[model samples]
Target: MGNNNGRKGPGRREILKSAGAVTATAALMSAVRASFPGGAFAQAAGPETDKVTLGFIALTDAAPLIIAKEKKIFDKYGITGANVAKQASWGTTRDNIVLGSASGGIDGAHILTPLPYLMSLGTVTAENKPTPMYILARLNYQCQGISVSNEFKGLDAKADASPLKEAFAKKKAAGKEVKCAMTFPGGTHDVWIRYWLAAAGIDPDKDVSTIVVPPAQMVANMKVGNMDAFCVGEPWNDQLVHQNIGYTACTTGEVWKDHPEKTLGMRADWVDKNPKAAMAVLMAVMEAQQWCEKMENKAEMANIIGKRQWFNVPPADIIDRIKGDIDYGDGRTVKGSDLLMKFWNGGVSYPYQSHELWFLTENQRWGKLPMDLDTKAIIGKVNREDLWRSAAKNIGAAEADVPKTTSRGKETFFDGKVFDPADPKAYLASLQIKKVA
Candidate 1:
């Protein structure tokens, strides 16, 4: 995230809300229609609730939610009272998600893909009390970056993380703590960095102390030498490279291409109580996703989300990376790489149950979840792909937009390890590094 150029303090945070759709005009509606010819959903029964409060972090993937609110897509879908608020950190997001809007928090949020499952099972919640949540949609995939301090710029780690193993070992040998940072403990950033380190034979759990830093604070903290390396979504990594504090070693997409990242998550009670309203939210976000996928809209999207009330960032830090232009900052720059973040990609938005299984398996591998846990049962309850399809149908989504099956098939990693969702045990057994058997 970009530095808050005079946009600091709590007052600006209070203004980080969606402009109500009440002021939407015919011109904007016509523009929205031009963006997606097939995206307009037929008028039906109005949403039960006109308003729904949601939360988002200062990350690029949160654009769908922001765009939905900013472009008045929520209003078009009959949710006139939609608001997307900025959250301080993933911890704050978790706390607010646990404390529903009725309790002065939020009803739903742009969350880490594994968070819904983690929150649902009480593993990541306080007092071990379950806060059931549903994964409504996969927000976006790939383009998140693993950035390293400029101290290792000469090493030119890039996609192969082997050089860092020796550097971290030497740092530890000097009796210094080798800290590797991520935004949240079982979130997408955590998984990406862990997988990258482990592929190079570095044990993320023992080789280095993994620390938690908020996405927005990554650049600031790194500038002060708070951490050696960090894994986070866009703008922060881009800012780090531009600030000369670090260079991006590689994007997480290099570890696993088109890998699932964040999700559109909501409280189960809220969805159950207001199913139609939830559908309205889904349709609006889905349409925004379509708007985000186009190449022409990227610049405008970056400018919109970079406003003071949203990410408080410059459009320069976001536009290039979002468009697949990566300046590694270590003398390597790739333009038009296939690793750009995908929003409404073909068959990409589906909330695949198999994707949830991979995260659950990884958490178990790292001892975050127990081996005996019934992950299948949890997935069945948390993954709402059925609702995704229903909303897609209601929105008149194209045939290419929806997947026939929930599984995206076997996924292969950079280490040549394959995770077959059908047989998670086989995949787990193949892993040489883990805290669990």
Candidate 2:
């Protein structure tokens, strides 16, 4: 979606330029590695498999995977043939992971945080065959947004959708629909939009039609009037504003600050067969996340991921949000904010079970999971925090970097509602709008 109409592949001239850049980056990383005690590139017991393919969708949050490949971090960790292939949509990502690498699919992916759980529960699988999966680390937090078309211009709406509900009702009476789009049905984007809509007394299930659109295709779809509003990760939301097609109503962080977004997910079978390799991949991504979190590296990161092969968006569009320079596209701007997308800072890389539990509860709220389901058992099997701890130790991460507790305790949302991990059911009951059947 970043204007790749004429490009087939990088021309010879472009290839040479990329090669030179890689060479310079390699030299820089080599010096940094040498300075660290025992060297960051020092290999432990070699990985079980030397090659592994991973899938990613075209979103800014997929930077960790791209950075790992570009900076040779995967190779340093002995994952020699690590491939970060781009995926068309979240549904395709699920199918490919279900197929597995032996069947010519990816062994892992930079995936929506809840997708691996859905896959493991046979919720999204075509054949209803559960594909066991594990979340190695959380890739990012925040930086997703809900954008509304020009039709809602000058509307006094922030976190509340009350202003839009009457408009939607009038449209419905006229046999027209007010639709909202998200990347996946039960994903973070969907949940965010749903929460925002419900907070304003608009029932997401009954008041509006919800649809799925891939991240890269969001702007194009919106431009052609496929949907009235959409919630997705950047830079599609930012692009909509740049093109004057829509304006960001509010960011997900504004809805709930520092909320978990994406994850580095892999098949549980693959991890079982290749424990050391899984740890190696985790270490590589962890280092890449740390590198991406640095203030100085953001511009370079935006440039690298904005290339045609990755996100395919312009660097200018991606750089602002990464640096916390947010333009809400409705005559509002924030020079910088701590609520920007986080890769490693604020214990973001650590996969908190409490967050996963919240996601699970939301899925249940939306009728994606049964209310009576044993959530703790499902979380135990899917969340491999033990592997994360082991990987952190092997990588010589500081003790403070690793959390002493698995849970981040009770989390409070922008709506003044609290989600206590210890009492998930009560939290669910307190929500006025839910479809927990």
Candidate 3:
């Protein structure tokens, strides 16, 4: 619905992404100037496109959508009629996609990773049946982090023990629940926080209580002590550091470097019905991703995305992180700006079946789903790789641009085990934490 950064949120990296979008657009404009020689700019020839609508939840990683719209990437791809609507929450975003509320009238949405999974495996509790959504492309990765309150700074557990041990000890010593929060259960943030905590020998179920709070409300809840710590996407984590209320204990990327963050999700039915429109949308977003990766465009990206109409936060706050600058506070900051976040760099944008399998395995491990479901079958039904491949090809994405043939990629879980997707059963069985199921 909204974002967590208190003062109009979009922190540093978002601003930089916005600037990059503009610079890319300017470069394209310059090409026109040289060729036209003071003549009128030629309108790109394509199908009549306008009034295309999309949805977002106001996170920093949503920058590419804003940048694309601002730079007319949609128009460039003949996708006019563009309107971006900020949904109330991830649930609402999910509901719209499932019920055909968003796609029935317009296009699709910038959705969370759990969406497709939930769609394939209905929310039995909610009695919601599978809606079968598909992702057009990936938006960004390695952008979320876990934040801890500054009040717990001096606790010896904070430094000497794992986060799980530290949180539990602090809570018991204070005679209060060491409450930790994440945006959603069965979502990437929750999975990372729980997996990370469990890796350090902390029982997420008993040692600490995990709660779900909306991203925009995380900082407020932490400020009022409604929660002790939270794992969320930028710029909320960055905002906490700046306010000195909290600090980044670990990045999701640290949990699994280059982990999936956000994606452009559409219903499978919608893709089947409007393949051309879907491909066009993918092309526009992919171009937007390329624009975001240009380092020189960082400043201009900040200016555009930091504006009142977009993320609407101070350009400085969003700039540092978007540019890959890290400020862990307590006198710690790093300038690995390239690590900030990325949108596109070829095959990195597709939704891999292996990625889905890892999430499914984690869900099963955490007791969110019953242990007997067929992981491969569910993944095949949910991933929609055929559609993604078509979109990628239409956009000129090469075969090598996609991820490895299998899910196996490089990962170093802080707990010390290296996960190889090729041997997932072994990876799941090797865990030392409680297996609720």
lDDT of 2 by residue, 152-173 (tens): 8688566676788888788889
lDDT of 2 at 208: 94
Q: Per-candidate TM vs. native?
A: 0.90, 0.90, 0.82
C-alpha local distance difference test of each model: 0.87, 0.87, 0.70
TM-score of 3: 0.82
Query: What is the Å distance of residue 289 in model 3 from its true position?
Result: 0.8
**What shift in Å separates residue 404 of candidate 1 from its native position after superposition?**
1.1
Is 1 or 2 the stronger prediction by lDDT?
1
lDDT of 1 by residue, 47-154 (tens): 568899999999999999999999888887678899899999998999999999999899999999999888999988999899999999999988999999987788
Better of 2 and 3 by TM-score: 2
- Please report how far candidate 1 places residue 142 from its true position, in Å: 0.6
TM-score ranking from best candidate downward? 1, 2, 3
Clashes, model 3: 25
